[model samples]
Target: MSNDHRRLGRELDLFDSDPLVGAGLPLWLPGGAAARHEVESYLYELERRAGYQHVYSPALGKRRMYEMSGHWHNFADDMFPPMRIGDDELVLRPSMCPHHALIFKARGRSYRDLPLRIAELGQMYRAERSGVLGGLSRVRSIALNDAHIFCPEDQASAEVAGVLRLMREAHEALGMGEVSYQLSLRGPGGKYGGDDASWVRSEELLRGALSKAKISYADARGEAAFYGPKIDVLVADPAGRSWAMSTIQIDYHQPERFNLEFAGADGRRHRPVMVHRSLAGSMERLFGHLIEVHAGAFPVWYSPVQLAVLPVGADQDDAASSFAADALAAGLRAESVHDGSIGARIRDAAGRKIPYIGMIGSREAPDGLVALRLRDGRQLDPMPQAEAIALIASIAAARSQELLP
Candidate 1:
């Protein structure tokens, strides 16, 4: 009955950590991986629709690259030690900004390419202390839903606003609980990069964007990234504790540091501004909150196992198999269980938090129908197998919160 994701994760077999594999790194089990893949696919589709060009970058970047991005200077303590191979010291990137910067610099750009949006679901590593590590919440290995937008200075506000809109949409679909926004500022005595005027302009730009979107946010000092100020998305868990899940930062420093520039309408070389953002931050940490908030019963859209098919004894095996095949073909996460009695199987499915249970029996099998048993103890009358599958598919496709129509 615990709401903790670590407990629920183990109970539902979503993920697990092993001593041999070392602390702070978790192994995503099949159920967990399946759900993750669905969410990742959704992000890719959403970003693509929003004009983001996805790119694949190597996991390791040279140490000089991090230094150029100011990560090695500011976050070196939290980053893993550089692996020395021959003359080059390669480090697992702590952030995707540098790699993305390299991508933006790979080609000449014009004002038309002003808001060049580049995205990646990339891997990063942190050298988190063992004591601070637990489950997926704080991990060494991370998969970040990261993106960078290189746009003209005038378009920075609009880009920030657009990121906020995208974040809201993603939060809604993912069932993130009670999300709040914060204007994280550059406070005193931190290792923040850039000049005071840059910080002030960045803050002002973010403020304009938030005001334009008519979104309310609280101001928090000293939480800004080393490079610039950010607008953070915080989600409250079931226990009423707040965790920062996503962020959008405006960086003028990186372009200067990397010497990133584009040709303007006047054919003048101008430094393009960089917008750093993630709609959903680390996949592992996001799911930690998700599992806790939902108590292992995710929304139908991303539920690890949406339908559990149980045939009434050996008589309905063929009918159940056929239904399952149809469900799979429709891109549904479905499973058929027949290793036990009907009652036991139903209970098993219920325990796993399966949203829909299709019970095929002697009477329903001949007609190619199924009786639906919902996780909430509702029973639906027998209906055509295709109709039931379609209904389930629609609910998932819509990312509906309801388990029943």
Candidate 2:
């Protein structure tokens, strides 16, 4: 059987939840938060480089907006009840695209600004059933890697393709191998919000984009959102269980309902197509998946504490502390321990799966050198402190999983 994330999460001290905090809500500890920060930073930089304008959208919105977006009618059961205060029914937003659509509607646009991509690490809430609540995988409060692209009808395919490329590259960088795609389309009847013509156009555009990208995808009928069709990326765990990781959805109904318009070359107002994409479906769930996939042996770049310094005795404490301080200053996650026996400290560090460990004793502490220990049970005797720091820092900077020489 594969490792369970809940068990590994406790052992690694990554995250936890209390009954007082309500079910399905997790509080990230410092170490866990550090790892999550790296993930978020990586995604943020990638999206920024790809011309995504990051924004902060409010977590709460008026019920009137969801009503207009048709989420109230289509997804009300999964949504939190509206909070009525001062004659305003405020709702914890279950999705961010509706708010993103409103943002586009707030400003008039010309053809020059057609493919405006607005991205956010948006906060969303859902009313999950108590019986199903467990770890981060099934959370009520979620941080989503959400983005919406408002583009012209002709540019929709290109936009969807761009998002697909982002998803593929991100998975590759994270070593999430062999992802499968599913193109979700509407079924029959009035369950779908948009007209048949609009749905067909959006579905065809997504299909063409996948075809142009040379990606094979299964057509999933009746799996689409009420507003539009979408493409879902599925990744398998070590045990071969598949989990949905990313989604690229094209919405025609919301754009129309919001009266979102852009001026075209013909000098007339036309509705802009909206594409909603989430590269890391949800932060909490992705982290949970990563915990199980990597089995708490995160790559150097993702490890909360990459190096642990263990001193042989109290006499060598200064050297160990100095080395650790220097490593931390060099932007490496490093820590020093002198409270227990050298063997005990190393054992603890190894148990935590720290990538590297430094052993300082009487002989090496005097010469400002330390013995290096690899997580794989290899060791180097009496290397210069500066050399070890530089090598480990370099490997970490490169984001490689390889052990240092």
lDDT of 2 by residue, 46-96 (tens): 899998999999999999999999999999988999999999999999999
Off by over 4 Å in 1: none
Q: Candidates' TM-scores?
A: 0.98, 0.96
Top lDDT model: 1
Estimate candidate 1's alpha-carbon lDDT, on a 0 to 1 scale. 0.92
lDDT of 1 by residue, 1-405 (tens): 388888889889899988999999999999999889999999999999999999999999999999998999999999989999999999998889998998999999999977999999999999999999878888999999999999998999999988988998998899887888999997888998888898888999999999999988999999999999999988876667678899999999999999999999998999998999999999999999999888889999999999999999898888898899899999898988889888899888988999999999999998889999998899999999999999999999898889866
Question: Which 10 consecutive positions of candidate 1 have the poorest summed lDDT?
Answer: 235-244
Model 2, position 279, has a per-residue lDDT of: 90
lDDT of 2: 0.88
Q: What value does the lDDT take at residue 172 in candidate 2?
A: 63
